[model samples]
Target: MENDKKVIALAVRATRRREQLGGLVLVAPAVVFLLLIFVAPIALFAWRSVDNAEAWSALPRTRAVLRAWDGTGGPPEPAAAALVADVNSLDRSVAATLARRLNYSESGMRSMVIALHGLSLSLQKPVLEQLIALNPRWGEHRIWQVIDNESGRLTPYYLLRALDLQLRDGGLTKASDQDGTFRVIFARTFWISGIVTLLCLIVGFPVAYVLATAKGWLGRLLFIAVLLPFWTSVLVRTMSWILLLQQNGILNRFLIDHHLISAPLTLIYNRTGVYIAMVHVLLPFFVLPLYGVMLKVDRAQIWAAASLGARPLAVFRHSYLPQVMPGIVAGLVLVFVTAIGFYITPVLVGGGGDQMVSYFVAFYTNSSVNWGMAAALGTLLLIATFVCLGAFRRVMGTAAVSGR
Candidate 1:
């Protein structure tokens, strides 16, 4: 009998282990899929934010020599010789690449580097004197300082620039007015997103409440109407808004015909157009989550509050709103994050001044071919999104516990 009991216990343990392994196997594909498709790209982009290999790779020997020099004086003789050797060893195309890389750190360095390449053929001994003779700028310690500073394989230059700051004289400082646009752009991005989220909340809450409390076909129809936008492409929906809201478009013409206005309003190609399109697209995001939460709310509690001599407004404030706070927080975070990163609608409908950070990210990635700046901007935006999400969760968690 004892042997049989031990056999049964062993069988139960084996069965549990098999179940656990099966569960893990079922989830393995999803975990691997997220790692490859989502996590890996994000990691690569974050790395690109600080990856500064161009200057170092192009002037490896020069970088080694520069590391030993004191920044207070003129370039040392060995560093100058290393620069000459490095320039001579590079092909013409590679030399041009080095010039471009240096130019990013200091404007006009490209022209100087290219001129040095030409002077390399007729070079004399003591390359330092020849370089100074070839270009007066080479005599300045600041010029070499810029080169030495950028010779690292990794740098905070792009990330600092994204935050409207700079590394100067081995320290952080505020960027100049011209280079300070990034902070303003980031502010604008968040400001617009916040406004859009507010608009969606104002419009979505009542609609979701009606949908949740209504009965029969009316509720179903309204829910379907809210979701109908999802069936259409966002680009198509934005274009449809343009057709309706543009000057001399259907909306303006209708208002003019009805004597509501004497002239067409300037709507498209501005912040107004951006807001209209974004709110229209993101309203459903707000509505769906609110509707789901409202559905789970206890109707009996609300009615009980009303029955106990509470007015309609009081009942709603005390009994209904608390239950729906989580959904409101979730919706706000989703809509704000999505609106912050919007590119297509903003580009198509917004003026240059109204464009968001995502537009600049695309500009750097595509037009400027400045991957470091693009990645740094993207990382900053991601960090902001995560911060907002964390704040929302913390606030909601507190509200949930306190309300109970």
Candidate 2:
């Protein structure tokens, strides 16, 4: 009997192990998919923010020489010689490429570098003297300092610039007032997203509540209406809003025909238009979650509260609101995150000043071709989204524990 029991125990252990292995096999594809599609791309993008390969690659000899030279007084003779040699070695194409890379660190560097390339061919005197004669700025300590500081496999320059900060005199400091625009733009993006989320909540809550409480056919109709926007492309919806909101479009024309306004209102190409379009696009996100939560709420509990001398408003505030709080939180997070990343709607419908941080990310990536700066901006936006998501998870976890 003891031997039989041992055999049964071993059989149970083997069976459990097989089940665990099967479960892992089932989940392996999903894990691999996320790593490849989502996590890998984001990690690569964040890496680009600190990757400083261009400078080191372009001026390898100069960088090696300057690495030892203290960034003070003036460019040393050896460093100057190395720079001239590096410039002389480069063909026009390579020199131009290096010039463009250096210019990103300091303006006018491209011109200085191109000029140096020309002067390097005919120079015979001391390299520093020739360089100074070519351009007096070469004698300045700051120029050499920038080159030396930027010659690294990794750098904080792009990340610092994203936050409107810079390296100066071996310490990080706020960039000049004229250059301090990125932080302000980030704040504007957050502010606009918050406003759009708030507008969606205000407008969508009633619609969701009606859908949740209405009779069968009416509820279905309202739910379908709420989801109708999802059928069309976002670009189509935004363009439709433009046609309706433009100064001489359908809305203004109707108001004029009805004698309700003196002139066409400035609606399109402004913050008002941006808010309207974003809220319309994001409203379904809010309503669907709220409707789902509200549908499960116990109407009998609300009725019992009303029977116990609670007013309708008190019953809603005390009973209905708590049940739907999770949905509200979920919807708020979804809408805010989505709004922060909005690109086309703001670009097409709003003015330049109203454009969000994503617009600048695209500008750097596509137009300016500054991959480092673009990646830095994208990283910051990703961090902001993750922070919000973490806060939401924390709050929701606390709410769940408290309820239990």
Candidate 3:
């Protein structure tokens, strides 16, 4: 009998080990997928922000002209010769295009273009004359200054601009010049996400509590309804909101018919629209976590508190609130992080003023062709999200430890 029991225990141990191995094998596919899609692209994009030098392609010209050239306008003759050869080789028309592209690499890049164009004219007048027609100012040293600055392999020009900083006179400084700076966009993004998180908590907490206390089949049905949003497309939901919130849409028509307001409310294509859509999309995230924690909560604890002469509100505030705080923190972190990266919902339902950081990220990547700025902005968002998640965990951990 003892031998049979030992054999049974060994079989169980082996089965557990096999299960662990199977789980590890299952995780491998996901790791590979992430490495190929998310990790590789992100790394490449981030690298572009700091990689400025065309060291291999234009090495001779770069070495010649830039050898004696400082950050100021006057580049050496050899550097000019190297640049002319490099530019002229890439395409006689490429000098101007390269100038524009490299300008993102360094400030005051116009001088480098001018310097290069002048050198091209001196070396090969026919090519320079044709190019010079496009921009007569190409003869000045300002263009060369731009070129010389950006000749390095790894550059911070795009990354710095993404953070509202610019390289001016060989140093990084804040860019207060334009209203559409990175700092402005970043701050607005943070504010919008924070507000959305607050809205979700304010609305979802009560709903979750009601769902948690519901009895029998009703509880299961209600919980399923709460989670139904997950099965639908976010874009579909966002578009639905746009249709419903428009001037002549169902919501406005109903309000107008009921004489709630004399005129059609400007609900769609505004910040309010953004808030409504975001809250709706994020509600499930808040509810699910709260409900999960609430399921594990002891109903008898509240009863015991009431029996100890605690009022209903006091029992709720002291016992119920603390018990569900972990869920609240988890839900808030998830929603806020997800909301910060929201693009399609905000774009479809929201106006220009309601664009989030993700919109700017897409703008820089697609429209502006500014990969550095895009990568830098994405990196900042990633860092912020991670920090928020970590803080949430810490807060929940401390609360749990103290609750004991």
Between the candidate structures 2 and 3, which one is better when assessed by TM-score?
2
Per-candidate total of colliding backbone pairs: 0, 0, 24
TM-score rank order: 2, 1, 3
C-alpha TM-scores of all predictions: 0.93, 0.94, 0.82
Candidate 3 residues 1-404, lDDT tens each? Answer: 99999999999999999999999899999999999999998788667667654433444566555757775654344554566667656654556556666655444464555455544354454543444465554455655555556666666666677777766667776764655566777787888889999999999998898898999999889888898889899998998998899999999999989999899999988889999999999999888888888888988999999999999899999998888877888788778889899999889988887888899889988998766678788888888787877776676785542222
Greater lDDT among 2 and 3 belongs to: 2
Clashing pairs in 2: none
lDDT of 3 at 192: 87
Which candidate's TM-score is highest?
Answer: 2
Write model 2 residue lDDT over 157-238, tens digit each, in one string.
8999999987877888887544669988999999999999999999999998999889988878888899999999999999
Which sections of candidate 1 miss by over 4 Å?
Answer: 1-13, 121-125, 177-179, 398-404
Whichever of 1 and 3 has more lDDT, that candidate is: 1
lDDT for predicted candidate 1 compared with the true structure:
0.87
Clash total of candidate 1? 0
Candidate whose lDDT is highest:
2
